[model samples]
Target: MKNPETFPHPIGLMLFNRFEYSQQVLMSLSAQTLPVDQSKLYISIDGYSGSKAELQGKPDSTHAIEELARATFPNATIRRAEKNIGIAEVYFALEVSMLESHPDANWIGFFEEDYVPSPDYLEITSQLASAAQPIDDIAVVAATGETLDPDNRDVQGIFPIGHLWAYLVRVAHVRERRDDLEVFRQQMSGRPYWDRDKIALALVMASRGVFPIGVANDYQRLSLMFRFNRIGVTTGLSYGEYIGVEGEHMTEKSFARFKFSAPTTVPFDIATVDFSASISTLRDQYRADFAKSLAEQYVIPKIRAFTAQKSFKSLPRRRRVASLLGQAFRALF
Candidate 1:
């Protein structure tokens, strides 16, 4: 069970106006340990928007970015939006350009402009993705797993979708639930790219009257890996590095606050790793932990809050039973 000889999926790279950032990633992807040149390469660029331009502090250089992508991946199927579809919608755009365009393909590769995959990224992440495929709950597998490697724990596992830097997703897995995916995409489409990234994990919990205990509530669009039961599966050791500090989500002044790693020049290798190992056995434990936490931290606090509302005492005992729970889970936003 050694790794596959060649990367076997179409690759979609999502970009907007970050020519500098996009250039760094494109060159890195072209230099993967696996010859990804054989895979169908598609670049989806969001159309120009004034507000996005204002946020980036530069006029949209979409045309220049498109040319740079063309120069990097010569045979890429480039799809540039005619109008400024926001960041959330651009993901849907990439899905259509890659997966929908190539119906026979079972899995597709994905990358954002800021993710710099290690040379061995294709080999390792694809192996991680294959391991995740049989398990129905794991939605996507990523290369950037463990940022700071821990001793004896540097193997792939079902972890939270930390950041969707470089990853692979199954076509059939998404296509099977096309309607649901679309509904989700539409739900977050109107938000800024920044909010979409963080709101995902919280969305499902919020709907069910759950919230994190002193944790920031932000799932992801790439983090869309969260739809309640689904979790991101990735190698425990980080396979890639996230370099987008000042893009949609961060500023130079605030970059240090997030504790981001400086982009690395060091090479990562997958020497003598076991390919036959699977993480299926650990899912139950993770779920059990989640249930335990939900019961203690998330659910109980809500119950306490609901009981605090004056409505609890204002209503007769019979009326309080059903409506009380409904108010807690209500989608006020």
Candidate 2:
């Protein structure tokens, strides 16, 4: 068993304009039972990317983030971008740099600004990662587990899709799949979706046959359906909560409601966990929902744009009518 007091992997915490969220995560990290050395904390703060009016109107929050990191994690390495490179690019660059600099690092933990880890979050994640290190198929050990019943937090299992809010991953596995991740990064960069980064990474991991080991929440399960065969989570313990109700990617009205629970105090061994059940039932439901999402997210708008095209409008009346009929046929079937 790996000693809880001597976890060797480094942790990278991604931050943007939200100071309060960042502080909350930092305080949560401070409360962990595992002794995380200050040097193991890497604070990556993104540059200001708002409109000129907002940038010039208010002081950038990066200044405040730097002060907080210096005060709280004095020995931590802080990387502050001079210009906005966006979240995906920032993480990609950070991962590349970390892999190059620390070849001996077996795994690395990533935490987003809004996620508040329970006191045992690090210990649990570290234990899972250490247990899964020798397993060839498991790529990620996530702290966020799925609670089957919204009212009951006890029902949890290893979800097919793992949340990136807080998780530990094998550095070597990610490095090996760097090319695929770059492709995903490019695809997401060209798209205009709220959770493009999350989707891109999830898709790339699925394509590579690397499934995450952790409890699957609804959003993660929905995102990962049809991508993997099975998913599961820890039976008795819950790890952390997604506290990001407001951010650049999400508005107050669009915020997702998440159930928060305290970490498990009982001693549990991750090595004993297994996910062997067929996911056909959930998979079927997910496929139906995904089809609806696809139509709404991609297909309908595309047809509307096609119909509004000048070339289509300039066609003869008969040709235009034919085009409309073709679009309707395609949409229905």
Candidate 3:
């Protein structure tokens, strides 16, 4: 609030090789009502040395991304890793860089190249952050609101899930949890970014009472979120589109299996909403959605596996129907 040259909330973007998406991000960011200042924009890109062959002779993509970023903002601070240090490491390192660079900032917004943010992304997240100031447990604020139709901006409510599509994380929480992340990093020290068994990671996290999903980096945050009984809030209407039909973690086949109740656009003219009032509404919604998702994602497969057991099939029809549930319940609990 004291300096006009400094951005209200310093922000950064984490990316690998998605130049086009990064460009879109920069353009949208540049167009922010909250202008994207060179002093405020930081870019952290992962190395592509190992993927030079995969990238088809583009071993210098990090340089290209830097050039592109500077051309847009002209003074953007860019951190390019020399080797492929992995997204998880790059992300945390970027956070530390932002913290050290903008010591006065209370929070930092982080984005990925896979999603294209709404023009109002900065303003909305700022409002969300301001509204969330008193709520310590709400560690992050996102623009991932859900609507039956993404194009229709009726503002159903804040999304109940922790979506990193575009998010703002509180500095205090990050400082408090940095040690936890270091421990997680140590646990995953030698593993390549793409080589993680996400299912196993989710299962391990579930045992610790955290939501059982996301990549290694995302999982690390989720663990901290649960550790302090914190939650992330989102806009009432989605603030971006997911154009990552095929990226590091998704393929055309895998992407097709996924669906969104909302389509591919964010409302451009949203007035500032005081989301602090609706925080509990979002929390309640998350509880219900998590319960439903847990059942559908975990329980049904378990029931199917139970019914398929030879011993289960051998039981009389009446007893087998009831007995199948016994095993599923045991597995679930």
Candidate with top TM-score is: 3
Off by over 4 Å in 2: 1-4, 49-59, 146-154, 187-237, 256-333
**Per-residue CA lDDT of candidate 1, range 184-223, in tens?**
5556556654455445635654464444432231223322
**Residue 17, candidate 1: alpha-carbon lDDT:** 75
Error of 3 at 247 (Å): 1.1
lDDT of 2 by residue, 1-333 (tens): 324574477788888777888898888887777767676777888876542314546567887887887788788888887666666676776676666667788888777888787777777777766666655445566656533323334444443332356766666556655665565567656532233456455555556553322112223332332243322223335676667776654546655334445555555566555422323443443345445554665568778998889999899999988988788667544
Model 2 has an lDDT value of 0.60
Which portions of model 1 show Cα errors greater than 4 Å?
1-6, 55-57, 146-160, 188-228, 261-281, 285-333
Superposing all C-alpha atoms, what RMSD in Å does each candidate have to the true structure? 6.8, 8.2, 4.1
lDDT of residue 293 for candidate 2 = 50
RMSD of 2: 8.2
> Each candidate: what lDDT?
0.62, 0.60, 0.68
Ten contiguous residues with the weakest lDDT in model 2: 211-220
- Clashing pairs in model 2, backbone N/Cα/C closer than 3 A: 145-215, 146-215, 146-216, 157-232, 157-233, 158-232, 158-233
**lDDT (C-alpha) at residue 186 in model 3:** 60
